[model samples]
Target chain A: MDSQITLSVNGTSRSLTVDSRTTLLDALRERLGVTEVKKGCDHGQCGSCTVLLDGRRELACLALAVARDGVEVVTADGLAHDGLHAVQQAFLDHDGYQCGYCTPGQVCSAVGMLEEVKDGHPSHVTTDLEADVELTDDEVRERMSGNLCRCGAYAGILAAVRQAAGA
Target chain B: MRALDYLRPESPAAAVAALVSNPNAKYLGGGTNLVDHLKLGIVSPDELVDISRLPLDDIQEYDDGGGPGLRVGANVRNSDLAAHPVVRSSFPLVARALLSGASGQIRNQATTAGNLLQRTRCVYFQDATTPCNKRVPGSGCSAREGYGRYNAILGASDACVATHPSDLAVALAALDATVVLLGPDGERRLPLAELHRLPGDLPNLDTTLGRSELITGIEIPFSPVAALSTYRKVRDRASYAFALVSVAAAVHLEHGAVRDVRIAWGGVAHKPWRAERAERALVGQQLEPDVIGAAVEEELENAASGDENAYKVTLVRNTTVHTLLQLAEGHR
Candidate 1:
């Protein structure tokens, strides 16, 4: 059941042998010693394990490491590689987290969400599907609904996302 | 979770062949639902045939001299399907349903076929300790007498009352979508409405899919009504929660009268309950509150509900009426 796989974490390449049941979140955190991606619910329900996989937002806890061979994974820490990402900077400025446990997920989700907005991805609240998408407050809230902050930092998170999107 | 073997097949044929040989194996899609089931000990498959990498992720336009339509690959992620230009423009209901179902992260990881095949989110079915007939054959359904807030209101049997949880399925059902499958014998197509099964005496079987049958894609024939459709989900919270009652409606009005309409209700049935009777009643009729109400009532005539979930009957009716009225207003 153990299979060897390679993952590009941040800018570094990591090779590890993981079990078939080893989720991407566990592979990144336990096997590769990359703990920036936290495991909150371990189920897809909580977005605490959200990460950018190949530039798309995905829940790490629900994905198997073996299934994602050679995929590039960018965590919240990866966003601050050279310097703090605009989203991370915005979060800090806006006080996006009372407790930092869910901050990583919130940051990663926001980054991916902004990219989606740029790509004209429509959310549930979007009324005009034909028009270009704007990073409105409702859009941000709907796009980031997967990630939950127990500290009730949604207000700050929303503000940070808007500021980062330059809305 | 128990350790399991993983096999990444080169093609759909190879995938089906691999599964045909192992009766204790499952086709791994996005792993959003199956992995959670693995962690919960709800299922124990010995092998996972990884079909995520199969060349079945494209959303293509096709016409077999029948009519213009779309063929959505089974491996297409929910988010990608939702954001696809064709899906958004030609089938906005699908996009809306996909967005209404899960969080952005979950949708990005969930596949179209996987969303259809996902097990019920009934609290009892999720708890391995609880006696769920759907999870284990003849184990006895705990939801029948337990917290029935999310249980079925229609097409339920004595054995089970768990409602189907896919918002996309409800939309597909309303749009008269068809499922394309590649089985051990050969490729075959089935109507989307017939894919899911009502839990009768045998609650373990969720779908009519044969063993070793791989869902290759879904076929949605283009329609003017479908182009003017929408999905509305009513849940406990605004997002990330399953529907309490949802409606996918497509209304085509002609000169202030209903020319055609398709209606499907979720969170109130074992499967996506296509409101054929409601559609029958609404066709050629004016889109008025009384007319919509009467049509919805006709559809709910056979709808039976438990004590805790009785509200779903009225909720689904109101939701259907509200959704249809909105669509009718848009048409004007």
Candidate 2:
């Protein structure tokens, strides 16, 4: 059976009929033709399907489409309204991606990562409980470890995140 | 994947009622683990009760007559739970263990209950074509005679040798946390230790949770030991990997002697292996290398290991002793 789901994507609401087995990844790519959300591994291992749901970054491939009815989804393509997001511009300025296959996911994850840092959410590397977590190299690397790059462009990625974070 | 039915239940009672009515129904939390299994044809539930919408995502501190305890909702994301101020201050071991598991993105999708009910990471069990007792009862155990370097060495039966792949469970077991479940009848509480069953013979069953039961939250009591706790994980990489052998240790030292202690190990057993024997041996004893060494030896006396997994025994011993020493050092 197919169910109708209304998804608030990038400030736009889209209603579509999808099967219960369809994941948010499938819905964005197959149903709505938003193919920017990569399907790497198709499993939950890779971070290629990362997206922001109500401002929280999550794996789109693992989230069921029906379960995400009426939630805001911000993918890499939707990150920038007019110009490129600061993180995206920083990626270009620093050559944060090589093959660019994983750039979209990395950008979305970094967007959400910055939001977490702004909200005072600490990472595993943050040792001092009394002080605010700084976006150091270790913290950025630990926070962005989910989005892996096959091209090994982590050095540039680190530079881009640091620039965008203004560290 | 099979065509599935989805039910969005707004209330916990409705969720349990939906599961109670359907014989083949599963509660979908964050879908980090279950969706993977569903895609691999590991499980095909006739109906999935979407409990993610329920309003159970609060982390609160309450005084239940005994002391100040924390109750974390089952739907609370792993990242949020780990970053909560109370959890970081009261149970840093839990926060560290949670952060050590999965990746930043996966933690955003994974929930508290899903982490506790995570399936084994054994390749045999994941590959549907292979024969695994935990995946298919009475089929056979493939890891027993196969490549089992990541398999269990403690509390493993011949039928199954797969380890529980949750670092959070190991810390929860050490904290003496209690799980709150809501069933068709009513709500009930069970200790996290008794929640996960050992693979004695029935490897098919994983937990003691009833078929229609929905996990509401977990309650962790306040203790001075948790303030001095730490989690040490030995893995293949620095992040995004299951533990090879990890230790979650909490201690209360008085005048340089171990007054109270708690220890739990992961990646070496069917369930979170609680080192009660070791804890008993260390209580009222000086924090010395020889004393911890003797306790580790006594705790691992009945451990049975396979050919490739014998290293886990030594790995577990070293990790446990190291964690104890670190906690003891912090005490001083």
Per-prediction TM-score, please? Answer: 0.99, 0.98
- What TM-score does chain B alone reach in each candidate, compared with the true chain B? 0.98, 0.98
Per-residue lDDT tens digits of candidate 2, residues B1-332? 87789999869999999998999989999999999999998998989999988998999998877678999999999999988998888898998899888988899889999999999999999999999998889999999888889999888898999899999999999999999999988999999999888898898888999999989999999899999887889999877889999999999999999999999999989899999999999999987888998998899999888789899999999888888898887721
Candidate achieving the largest DockQ: 1
Q: What lDDT tens digits, residue by residue, belong to model 1 across residues A55-154? A: 9999999999999999999999999857889999999999999989999999999999999889888998998777799777888888999999999999
Span of 10 residues, lowest total lDDT, candidate 1 chain A: A128-137
Per-prediction DockQ: 0.87, 0.77
- Span of 10 residues, lowest total lDDT, candidate 2 chain B: B323-332
Looking at candidate 1, what is the lDDT of residue B22? 97
Candidate 1 docks at the CAPRI level of high
RMSD of each: 1.1, 1.3
Q: Which model scores highest in lDDT?
A: 1
Residue pairs in clash, model 1: none
